[model samples]
Target: MNGTICQSINQSINQSINQSINQSINQSINQSINQSINQSLSLLQVMEQV
Candidate 1:
């Protein structure tokens, strides 16, 4: 009984940690992608004007 309880507690902790990590990773990835896309778009516009 004690072992099962400990296992469940560990599982919950691991799940929460994984969730937070994934969220942060996804957020940063999205931000970088947006930045790169915006930069490229601006560059294209400048090229067109030139």
Candidate 2:
């Protein structure tokens, strides 16, 4: 019984770690997308000036 409890606790910790990693990855992706959008907008503004 104690072993089962330990196993469950370990699984929970692993899941939490995985979730944190996934969240960081998503955040990085979102940041890159925003950066790309900003770059595109800047290019459009420059083209309009010409």
Candidate 3:
């Protein structure tokens, strides 16, 4: 009975860790995309000026 409870707790902790990691990765990907978009826009503006 105790072992089962421990196992359940471990599973819950693992799931939380996995979710946090996934969220972090998604945020980084979003930031990268935003940076790329901003850079592209700046380049376009420069081209228009020329």
Candidate 4:
């Protein structure tokens, strides 16, 4: 009855929260990886020029 409805709503909220957290974490990891790779490439180009 009312208890079941409340439980359902809570579950939905928790799911959305979990999804948002996962997405942010994934984006952060990807950005760091891209930055590191770009840095290494730039370093290599500089070394070549020298």
Candidate 3: minimum summed lDDT over ten consecutive residues — where? 21-30
**What is the Cα-based lDDT of residue 23 in candidate 3?**
100
- Runs of candidate 1 exceeding 4 Å displacement: none
TM-score of each: 0.86, 0.85, 0.79, 0.80
For residues 1-50, what per-residue lDDT tens digits would candidate 4 score against the true structure?
99999999999999999999999999999999999999999999999999
Q: What TM value does model 4 have?
A: 0.80
- Give me the runs in candidate 4 sitting further than 4 Å from their true place: none
The candidate scoring highest on TM-score is 1
Model 1 lDDT tens row, 1-50: 99999999999999999999999999999999999999999999999999
Candidate 3 clashing pairs, residues 3+ apart or interchain: none
Tens-digit per-residue lDDT, 1-50, candidate 2:
99999999999999999999999999999999999999999999999999
Clashing pairs in 4: none
RMSD of every candidate to native, in Å, equals 0.9, 1.0, 1.2, 1.2
Each model's C-alpha lDDT? 1.00, 1.00, 1.00, 1.00
